[model samples]
Target: MKPLHRLLALALAVSMPGGVALAADLRVMTSGGFTAAYQRLGPQFAAASDNTLSTVLGPSMGKAPQAIPNRLQRGEPADVVIMVGYALDELIRQGKVAADSRVELADSRIGLVVRAGEPKPDISTTAALKKTLLAARSVAYSDSASGVYVERQLFEKLGIQAQLAPRGTMIERIPVASVVAKGDYQVGLQQVAELLPVPGVTFAGKLPEDVQSVTRFAAGIPTGAQHPAEARQLLDYLASPQVQGTVQATGLDSVPR
Candidate 1:
């Protein structure tokens, strides 16, 4: 369906009564990459179903105190978790989450940002992206998956690891664009969904296809969840094609069903 049609469909759905049998309170722990869409769609589900949501925002990985895994390891109360697919799988492997509860929600690609009002740099091709990096006074990336790829693999892939080493930074527990917007860095790279929401930054465009890091955002019900059935209802809502236009609007591409 077209964007408009999808939005209208979702609107109609939200306006109608929901199918869940009873109202429940759901605790959701979601990482930054998928937060935008979740924030938008979550309330729709809640309003339609008469459930209430308590959301906690965090990263999919890294040692940050608010990282989703750390939150889970600490036994934070949560019914469902939305994060990078691999991270959710790690939770499953650790027996913190149920493998059968997993559902793929979206794929988020890495993109560039410069402080708002600054000229957007060229990242139209691999060579152009490299050139922009080389010319940058300082480059910032997240401490999450996309940054891991850029810091540990992409520079080596571009064969500029040594040259870019001194000027690169790994931003933690916050949006890369936030730093770029504050003039702390000349350019920043992070999941496109994470980048587009921050103010005072201009999106430069995604990295070249060959170098792009696309993280799959998936959700799962954690073991010992107090509201398993309600969590499944939310998981179904998030992964549903019915609200995909809102997902794309948040810079996430819907995963193929």
Candidate 2:
């Protein structure tokens, strides 16, 4: 080989891996409920892998269970999606997400919140929770999954559905704890994981054993993802023990079994 050609070949070989590494970015579309935990993990993942992550956070609007699907259907770019378990399954059934890429990350249970410095109320039983709800002058909750469940089923069962319907407030996007903290409501209800991050609010406790609602969260690579391997690595990092303490601090329990 000519001397110039030999030097060019050596340079190309040296640069190829760097080019491949620079070609990808992990695009993640995740629900707002998981935002706190992801905020901690996303940076660590990026630093360790030399890959960039772009995260879009919000509840699935309109007809989609996750924002990623709605974006994907419209030709948006997404490498991975993190959302409630059942929602991710729906995406898999539609062939938008890789079935084998699905991973259960954590389970978030619903809980009650009060303003910081206020006395926490007893919610250790279904009957006690019902009494507490009815007695509260005002109550706030999300417009998301836990809130919907409370509105559609739990409140009715407690026999205060009518009263709550007239006065209960449903918050969207913003954490319910913020509402309670501002004195807009006497109590707030949302995922335990969500409640922990808001300033000026205190976690009361999870719902009683018999009536608790736990939402399981999972992640999956989109079927046509440009960075499938990186997406898997991010998911693995989320489920690893190194991230477990951060997950717990955010009030989410690692998925059991």
Candidate 3:
């Protein structure tokens, strides 16, 4: 979306009265990484556009029932899907989503977390992160994009994938930080934004640049959307400059201009 277009959308949003122009409720499916922002911004959009939001939270990928793509495949009612850009692209190719409706929302990077009060592990460098992973009794990563990178590339890049396999686990459909907080794992890895909302955990910081992965989140209306027009309004509002602050405050970097 261009800056001028975003401003136009913002202007339109500001001009409308909530529940006047849009009276139908919209069903939204969003990945965990972007859920927090949606939760906070959904109400605002509803008030401004008069559209109600019924949001379903899930991952962008994985076999889990809650994964966005899986729900869509099973005939769930989703007016809009906010998820990984590449995953949205795949849905477009599969004829499940409207390619022309895709809108990039934000980007997120991987971060580490530990149970609250635990000695925060040092991950200031590639060597330090490798050492920390080796020492943890149980290490967990999300089953989504960040997890895939940690499982497939980060460990291998550190040359300790074989050594860490015995203790490392891929956390499925659950927040890695929450599990770590409960002591299921000593260290948890996930998108930084996704980890911040989990209670009883301390953010350790992002992965070193040498081993970091950034996931771009985008929104698109489903081909079968019940409220495609309303969905587009919500997407535009989300990408408007007014909402970028909330997006960043929730741990994501707004889409690059």
Candidate 4:
């Protein structure tokens, strides 16, 4: 459906209330990459469901000590979590989230970012990317999924791990593109969606097809959720076909349910 049609349909669906009362409040924990879509769709969900959303932002991995799992381990209250699929799967295995409640939302690919107006470097191929990395005065990547790939896999694949490590910066629990936008780092690598939202940065492009890691972002209800049913409703709303455009607009490719 077109975006306008989807919006109208959603408005109508919410206007004709059915299940759970709108008075229920929901707490959601989501990674940075999907926040743009959540921010756009959240208000509409609230208007329709008559419920409020409380969101927490954090990375999906690394040693930030505040990644989603760490937050959940610390007993942070959340009804739903939107993060890298594998991370959510780990939570499900640990019995922190409902296995059956998992819903795949979108696919994200790693991209490069440079300070706005700076000369964009070539990353059109694995070799060019390797050279770019080797020459960058300072390079930053997230402490999240993309960073893990850049740190543990990409360099090895490019045969330049040793050369890049000394100057490679792992941005812990924060958006790598944001730091690059501030000129704190000469180049930044992170999910395309996460890079698009930050100001003062120009996206160089996704890593070459062969080397790209397209991370799947999914959502699940927490086992200890205060409002599991309502959380499911919110998840349904998020994964609804009508919002696929919103997902794509945020630099993610919506997963077909």
Measured against the true structure, the TM-scores of the candidates, in listed sequence, are 0.92, 0.84, 0.92, 0.92
lDDT of each: 0.89, 0.80, 0.88, 0.87
Candidate 1 lDDT over residue span 1-257, tens digit each: 54634453455455445822566899999999999999998888777666799999999999999999999888799999999999899999999999999999999999999999998799999999999999999999998899999999999988899988999999999999989999999999899999999999999898899988789999999998998977887888788777899999999999987
Question: Residue by residue across 1-257, what tens digits does model 3's lDDT show?
Answer: 54644454466555456723546799999998888998988887776555688888899999999998999989999999999989999999999999899999999989999999998889999999999999889889989999998999999999998998898999999899989999989999999999999899988898998889989999999999988878888888788787899899999998888
Candidate 2 global CA lDDT score: 0.80
For model 1, what is the C-alpha lDDT against the true structure? 0.89
lDDT of 2 by residue, 1-257 (tens): 54433443343334445534343488899886677899988876676556789988766433433455567788777898888888789889999999999999998889999999888888988888998898899989887778877878778877889989877887876789998999889999988888888899878899986777888888898898998876776787788766788888888888875
Ranking by lDDT: 1, 3, 4, 2
Off by over 4 Å in 2: 1-23, 60-69
Could you tell me which 10 consecutive residues in candidate 2 have the lowest summed lDDT? 4-13
Q: Compute the lDDT of residue 56 as modeled in candidate 4.
A: 86
Q: How should the candidates be ordered by TM-score, best one leading?
A: 3, 1, 4, 2
List ranges where model 1 is wrong by over 4 Å: 1-20
Model 3 lDDT vs. the true structure? 0.88
Best by lDDT: 1
